[model samples]
Target: MEYTEELLNEFYNPANVGVIKAASAVGKIVDDENGEIMKIYISVEKNKIVDAKFQTYGCVPSIACSSMATKMMIGLTLEEAAASITASAIVKELGGKLSDTKTRSAEMAEKAVKAAVKNYSKK
Candidate 1:
């Protein structure tokens, strides 16, 4: 699978690759097929995401997607991020798309964001 330079850059030097100890929202997901895991942490203020971070154990695409998703979510309202942060968007931001086998990576990132929003709503 060929990856764009932008995608490779994200994979090599992923941003927001950590945890927020006092995150306002947190979400996690696991890929049963491969045991890959992704966790997202978000801090919200005035209904907007003030910050975001992630920890992922998976392929390059997964790590890149998670990093891109978190960067995209920051500064967005909870509702906006939940509704707008789709797999396609993450792929696009990463410079087009991922291989068929790695498509789930972007999906996982999307799901994680939605899960974080859901967690915040419950609080």
Candidate 2:
């Protein structure tokens, strides 16, 4: 698959690629088919996300999507991030579309964000 320069950049030098030890929320997902796992950590303050990070073990798109998703979440309110961060949004941020097979990576990012918000709400 042909990846955009933006996507390649993110893939090669992903941002927010770590854990937030004191994260307010955390989300994790695994791709059943590929056994790829993605984990997101978010630290929220005053209803806003002060920081976000991710650890993904998968293909290039998975890592890129996770990185971009977390980067996009910073400074966004939890509600806004939850509502605005979608698979399409992640792909868009990555500068274009992903193949059908790789689209799951973006979806994983979306699901992880929602899961993190849900986890936060429960606390």
Candidate 3:
């Protein structure tokens, strides 16, 4: 199982790797398939994501997925972010394909974003 440079770069220098003290919303998801969990924090204004971050306990693919997903969310509206983030997108951003396990990384990212959005809507 070879990893791409993009994947390694994201895993090593992950972006948005923390919690927001004053976040507008927070979301979390656990991949029961792999015993991994990802929690997302976001600050939204006028339906746009002003900031995003995530904390995850998982593998390199998970980190890369959340990093890229959070970065993508930073400037997008909630709907747009939800529509675009997916497991396939993660693998594509990494410039490679993934097995089923790696694919779950993207799903985790997607779930995190959706969870945050759902929480935000409650406000």
Candidate 4:
């Protein structure tokens, strides 16, 4: 079985796949041995996620997972942000069944959100 065209398109053409001009928090996760490097950049206002972006140099599923996670977090409150976001959620949202290797991307997304929250909480 191969990744569907729709899935591949989503991965190739991620929605928020850039860096925020002014980021409130930026997080990086890399497991060299595992070959996962996920970086997320986010901008917030009043503790709400106003803008978000991600840059990842990984497989298609990893990229797609992070990209979709960033898309889902936009316009979410700090509290609401924590409640949502998960690898399973991304997989389900993306029509399900991403390669197991890409699972780290979802964890990266969760960590990124937590990193943003931690940054905001410090202020």
Q: Please tell me which predicted candidate would have the highest TM-score against the true structure.
A: 1
lDDT of 2 by residue, 1-123 (tens): 798899999999999989999789999998888989999999999999999999999999999999999999999999999999999999999987799988999999999999998899999
lDDT of 3 by residue, 6-117 (tens): 8889999999899999899999998787899999999998899999999999998888888888988899999888888777776788876667646778888888888998
Model 1 C-alpha lDDT per residue in residues 1-123, reported as the tens digit of each score = 799888999999999989999899899998998999999999999999999999999999999999999999999999999999999999999889688988899999999999999999999
Query: How does residue 76 of candidate 2 score in lDDT?
Result: 95
Please give the distance, in angstroms, between residue 22's alpha carbon in candidate 1 and its true position after superposition. Answer: 1.5
Model number with the top lDDT: 1
Predictions in order: lDDT: 0.94, 0.93, 0.87, 0.76
Candidate 4's C-alpha runs over 4 A off are 4-6
* lDDT at position 90, candidate 1: 96
**lDDT (Cα, 0-100) at 92 in candidate 2:** 95
Model 1 bad stretches (over 4 Å): none
Model 3 CA lDDT for position 118: 89
Candidate 2, superposed: residue stretches over 4 Å from native = none
List the lowest-lDDT window of 10 residues for candidate 3. Answer: 95-104
Candidate 3 lDDT score at position 103: 78
Q: Model 4: which ten-residue window has the lowest total lDDT?
A: 97-106
Model 4 per-residue lDDT tens digits across residues 9-92: 778789888887768887677768767787778788887888888888777777877788788888998778767886677777
What is the descending TM-score order?
A: 1, 2, 3, 4
